[model samples]
Target: MAEGLFRFAAADLDDVEVSSAGIAAYGGDRVSPETLQILNERGVGLEGFRSRMVDEGIIQQATHIFCMTRSHLETLEALYPQACEKLYLVCEFAEIDGEVGRDVPDPIGGGRGAYEQVAACLDQAIAGIIGFLRGTGKGQAG
Candidate 1:
């Protein structure tokens, strides 16, 4: 969801490259039907989008790496200490409903409502992310 939203939101920017990978995902797995529905409702399509696991190549190429939870951050940091400087929680740039430092809950298997809530959270966070990137003059790549 974050990947699709970021790609749609940052579509106008040529310098930014948006991609999503999971810390525990099998390559070529399809996104959940709920995810497809939510994105489709927002006019964002995830056609040909298959899941991929995070690897050294992805880490080395990213200018900024946003994780959904602190656990994810810890995992990535432990595995790729050299990229620690670029690691960040996706919601770090914005607060959801006046709350700060909250993990963007994983909606997997939680049904449609859960997915909807996550999409809303990602919508706000993605906007803040764009603002942050532009403000820092680091929108060249991500």
Candidate 2:
């Protein structure tokens, strides 16, 4: 979800700062071949891409933060209450019911179809987020 969402969300929010991180993402793992192929076909750049972990500074510095699931939102809150108000579950803004949807399901070890499914969901979520940010008059992505 991070991989695919970054592609669309980054472009949508090109006006706003955009970046993705894992709670414990591996550092510099070459993006999976299937992922690269999928995003590339969509014309999203895969160059200069590398994975990294979500750290305190990231949560601290972000004006608004988005996570893939409720667990992630909870984790972020547990670690930093000061940043909680700014955090959101990517699906939340879209009214997708993430707690019951569980997760977007990591498509990493899967095949092309799995990645595509993940990408689609992320694209919708990103659209919702972009709209939400715009509505709040928090017009700047911070």
**Winner by lDDT:** 1
Evaluated against the true structure, the overall lDDT of model 1 is: 0.88
Q: Which 10 consecutive positions of candidate 2 have the poorest summed lDDT? A: 94-103
lDDT of 1 by residue, 3-99 (tens): 9999999998767888889999899999789999899988999977999999999999989998999999999999999999999888888989898
Q: lDDT, candidate 1, residue 44?
A: 98
Best by TM-score: 1
Could you tally the backbone clashes for each prediction? 0, 0
Worst 10 residues of 1 by lDDT: 133-142
Question: How well does each candidate superpose onto the true structure, as a TM-score?
Answer: 0.94, 0.82
